[model samples]
Target chain A: MSAQDILVLAEVNQDAVADITFELLGGARELAGATGGQVVAVLLGHDVAKHAESLSAADRLIVIDDEQLADFSPAPYLAVLESLVGSEGPRAVLAGSTTIGLDVAPMLGAKLNAPVVNACQQVAVEGDLLKITAAICGGKVLAEVEVSASPAVLLILPGSFRPTEETGAATVESRPSPVELHRGAVTFEKMILPAPGDVDITQQDVLVAVGRGIQQEDNMKVAEELAAVLGGELAASRPIIDQGWLPTTRQVGKSGMIVKPKCFIALGVSGAPEHVEGMKDSELIIAVNTDPGAPIFDVADYGVVADLLDVAPALTEAIK
Target chain B: MNIAVVVRQVPDLVEPLEIDASGAALDVDEVEFLINETDDHALEQALLLKESGGGSITVVAIDFGQVDDVLYTAAAKGADRIVKIPYDDDDRPPRPAEAAAMIAEAVKDIDAELVLVGSSAHDELEGVLAPLLALKLELPYLGVIRGVKPGEGGSVTAFKEFPGAAMAQMNVKLPAVLGILAADQPPRYVPVSRIRAAMKSTEFEEKETAAAVPEPNVTVLRMHHPEPSGRAEMLTGSEDEVAARLAEILKEKGVVQ
Candidate 1:
């Protein structure tokens, strides 16, 4: 209660500060401002000090370098966070809603009896109260959560905020990484990748995703023409791919590949919870469907309530 | 060894949804309830563990939205036991932390050596339930786990989804909770007859410990229907007109050559 520290855990991967870590700092700084507190960034990794100079968003940087922490294991990481929260008694803890953050935040919340707000896309201060807006029902609805408890841990969604414009070699404090839990009950074995095919959808910046609304197999030519005119790759929802109209490689959804393209044209795609799970993160989601009540419109940045058959070729011709 | 899989019933997203008169809650009467999506994957993981290693799996569901049907489905998928925590949709835990509290109590009473839950549930949407439950049970937890296999000793090897479909192979100690994203395989489809047979033979134990459902620390003051931010410019009129407008916007965004 005394320190009132606003802490952000700076996560590193492949020897660099990940973008999400920077995004968290951007959030932490804004939160720190309203609370009249100091923003502290904690870097825990092997030789992670190199990243200390880049987290300019922090008022202070605490670097804990340990070879044992080269990989993320919940046991040791939780031990470190628990001990830190115990000592610092921060006002709020913010981390990226990433693989590592997801693993660590709730565990910390549980240990401290603090509440956790996950996947909050926005954080703001409303008259001395900290508030977060989070997606619910796969983005069909939004919930603005206000914590009843201080020192609440927030797992923030990435791409929600912009990073600090400038870099500062913040005042650095190096602490000997805790050796108390030299090893965790969990151990990392190896890393494996999903089977690769001729087309790597992950690299595509824009995708023309079709769904059952595309109707007959022959109708796909219109989608292909639209995709070609747009200079983007053609993909499909699970139903279309399930019908063998496209290879698994061109599928987009929870069971398929998770993609964050710069722009996604969901032509005739009915946004199911599973499908939205994968593509909701797109920068701009344009949903075109005949049903004005299509669930995709709930999260779409632009909506065209019309049949794809009428629009696809007309759009392709217009573009050409 | 006993593995406890936490299942929750939620408003089936495919069905129509209506906000109740209270504004803060959904109209449970109108909405169809189904087992939360992630929970299905979690049950699959537990069943996979049961097959690979000699163990019994106990499926636990907080009574709501076709709990018996989902529990029976789990039985047909080979869960050895089932437990239902009597809960009222009207008076259910308002937040994920509180929900985890009820689940943690049930897990302890069952004396489960391993816990599996969906990475995220529809109702909570916090993506924190598994970790919160793990903490409440004083167990190590992992999130967004794809595959799980019982390891040589008292540990389990898990495949975790990373950026770009990469996976990190990790071994966790037993008595841990895993937030499952996918299982070793799609949950086996249980035939309707098997589910019916499960209904006849499988017995459900009600946890009397959850009688005192605690009040939520967080409360929603009001509810809001999204006002289309006006940022989302709707395209209307004739097909050609809409298409022309879209093309103009695409060209401005440089999405088109």
Candidate 2:
């Protein structure tokens, strides 16, 4: 009930607590140290109490179980969060910069008349205010922002914070729904999964990834040849997947698979933040693009400022 | 059904961006502006819906960053009406909250059954506008929708994307807001002659509304391009030389052995 507390909105997927929720808990723990308040994790779902046992980084866990929250609909989630935030006033609320978090933050900001910051890569508490560095313009630029208002809603990008190693016994409280629930205008019908039986890029040891600069479908043969020479698989950025040159399963990005292969070779990939977040943790990274200023070079261990179209075939021939 | 689509003009990212003197934003004068990619998809979705279900699309935009060209192009692609909210401030682009407030003010009287906007933009990667606009109008919102089709009895079926490439088919009632990630088909390529014809015949309906900018909650302290971390060892040479070096490196790492 302390105003200095930092509140974390727990996100659940497939009836289990999501990894991003743990990331949020880790971030909240750090912010709570400065605010001098306990870290409070609010879990909202149907039959979610069992998931709270893993949120050890939080000092307190609050679970709200209700039938209205069985599936994530915007209206009911907003209603519950609004009432909870109003009653349990905290210095700031942290959520993932994810599909669900992006959908929820703005609505909650409007409902509470609070300021919302998104795409936060780093956050710190300065005296009574908060300082955040947000990655915007698709990771080409970074903006440092100051939150001068209390009760701010901050949406953190995934992979910005590591999960906390501290294992503490958090006191749990099961609370009832604070507001009446009704069927909203939006109804979730069913979940659709990606098609199976494709090469799982996440399980690969060596990956050759292409991007829009690969020219067209014809150029894909070059990358495939290189991957074959290396005995590896082929992956692509979002544009390649969107253009249907590669299937969604071969896409490596925020919306696709997060891969950490032993050897990652990126061709013609400009390395937008969304794409970089998926493969930045590879054991060894190599990138080749025509543009010298491509952001992919920032994370790549080796960079070649040349056309991947020329390098791919030549490298494949050399390897063969 | 009457649908309203919000089209925005953003800096073309193909060109390298130069940081402004203030170190807090882009140097707008040097960059070229184009219709945002997803917003173009939103316009295309609106057109597809009109063709299939017999509806009218009223394209709306704030008068910023060559938005007139986008409106004209929408008209060329079969938009029924063009609505422009008067915004002359060019020193900086409107924040998400302010833009959503202004858009809500402009579109409230149109009585549109559905409002479609791009799910995210390059400048504001957070994609907060659609939900903020929905809250301001007291309408239910669904963001990150890939494809949408008209459903039975004033409802639309939307395929909303989740993390890990999962999707959910959602049934949304009329008078809702959708943040479109992509439309069913790619945006049609309207020829130059069609745009010229639209320019001659299309009349923009100017809607003047007092800008109600909410109090600033977040203020930019600084902005800059990411400094190279020196992690990448630049291999500078001709194509053959670089390819030879890459082959050697791969062999050393046992990747191409």
Best by lDDT: 2
What DockQ number belongs to candidate 2?
Answer: 0.69
True contacts kept of each: 0.54, 0.76
Model 2, C-alpha of B214: deviation from truth (Å): 1.1
Model 2 CAPRI quality = medium
In TM-score terms, candidate 1 sits at: 0.83
Steric overlap count per candidate:
0, 0
Please write out the lDDT profile of model 1 over residues B1-257, one tens digit for every residue: 68999988777654666777877666778778887767888898888778877789999877766678999999998998898887755533335676787888888988888899998766674437888888788887888887888776788888886654567899988878889877776667789999999989999998845533444544454344444444456888898899888888887777875
- The A-chain TM-scores of all the candidates are 0.76, 0.95
- C-alpha displacement of B71 in model 2, angstroms? 2.3
- Error at A132, model 1, angstroms: 2.6
Model 1: per-residue Cα lDDT over A77-155, one tens digit each = 8888888777777888888777788888877876787777776778776654667777556455567667757777887
TM-score of each: 0.83, 0.96
Q: Worst 10-residue stretch by lDDT in candidate 1 chain A?
A: A135-144
Off by over 4 Å in 2: A215-219, B125-127
Q: Any runs in candidate 1 off by more than 4 Å, and if so which?
A: A1-4, A194-198, A202-206, A210-263, A267-285, A289-302, A306-320, B88-94, B109-111, B125-127, B210-215, B232-257
